[model samples]
Target: MIGNDVIDLALARKESNWKRKGYLDKIFTADEQAMIVRAENPTLMVWSLWSRKEAVYKIHNRTAHFRGFIPLKIACQADGKVLCGGQFYFTDTIVTAESIATVAVLEERQLSQICYLQDREEVVKKEGFPYRKTNSKPVSISHHGRFEQIVTLTD
Candidate 1:
């Protein structure tokens, strides 16, 4: 499976003009751009969408060749979600048929908001919960979802 990891340029490195625009078009769909217009700085908004798209690509296992994927018709949504790449759609409709997303914010610490839209739930950060162990080891050391979720992760 393919995986992609995106970081906020503001939190990592400065982005060049070409990198910003190129990635903006490469990642977000038209409707998504409009929905995120509150940000006066095109850079930050694009950056947020970038993170979400990257996460979706990872979940969809299309990160190996993101360019093969297209927005809207193939793998992007207006409300900040993504489908799988078109190239593999016929063989694997599940990828592009559903939506997936992840978001990262630069708060005091690096906070990542992971969303698996197909599951109709988001991966959120959780704390202060009873610890469950599996195989005599910590099951996981991450957060859980607030909304009803069918899938979970432990790492």
Candidate 2:
């Protein structure tokens, strides 16, 4: 039972001005802002934090009454791999297991003169009681624009 998520830093740089600022104030808190970013155009930093947040949040939905983005953290190094509070690292990679396994990919990239997203999700449920629901639903959302971002997800 593992999950990962990603977002385009370039797309966010070119596309969003309002959602960047709006979510900054609305979704992120003061400590979260201070912890991840110390820049003026904090949108990209915000998204970086967000991509990690969503990645982990997908695995464990928002159950912590956290006032800010809590499950996501990034190292202040060159490779900003998403961290899940522990030694967990999240990046573009693939892992395999013998039991049940699942994977999710969400990304936005700029190719040539166009920007697009490649989103996919896969679930493998092991042999268990079918009544309890052990498989995750694959979520894919694609958009075409200079920046294609998942604006919102209601539950």
Candidate 3:
């Protein structure tokens, strides 16, 4: 399975105060919190990790048949590997001045097959999940503030 998430930095900064007391604790593990603290850009790190978790959560829900956002329950390593129910999902993340985007796959090798598309219209809904219309490849679309990402797999 494939999944993705995106975060717009400007809007995030305007909307959330990540430094607020207990916010990091509520969403991150102790180790994750440490990473954020040590990061040169703590704000970027927080959202990067969050986007990774959100991307992995999409795949987790498909296999586990569960719903809801349980951030701490899903653990993410600094290397973009996410642990959910003992299963490992690998993620590829992009960080820019304005946004952060992440794409996840069940197998690490699948990461190489991921393709980011500029055409949003290629996406269609199947059982409420996104997919590419031409080849029916699973598509993950995420929009936040001014940024959006459309991801799919090839073969």
Worst 10 residues of 1 by lDDT: 89-98
Tens digits of per-residue lDDT, candidate 1, 21-80, equal 565555556666674565675555554455455444443432243343544433434443
Which has the higher TM-score value, candidate number 2 or candidate number 3?
A: 3
True-structure lDDT of candidate 1 = 0.35
Candidate 3 residue-wise lDDT, 13-97, digit = tens: 9999988999998999998999998999888999999999999998888768899879999899988899987898999999999
Q: Which stretches of candidate 3 lie over 4 Å from their true place?
A: none
Q: Model 3: how far is 62 from its true place, Å?
A: 2.2
> Order of candidates by TM-score, top first?
3, 1, 2
Writing each residue's lDDT as its tens digit, candidate 2 over 22-75 gives 555655556666755675545545554555455445533322223444432423
| Model 1 bad stretches (over 4 Å) | 1-4, 11-13, 18-23, 62-80, 85-152
Residue pairs with colliding backbones in model 3 are: none
- By summed lDDT, which 10 consecutive residues of candidate 2 come out lowest? 93-102
CA lDDT, every prediction?
0.35, 0.37, 0.90
Model 2 residue runs over 4 Å out of place are: 18-21, 36-44, 62-155
Task: Give all TM-scores, in the order shown.
Answer: 0.39, 0.38, 0.95
* Best prediction by lDDT: 3
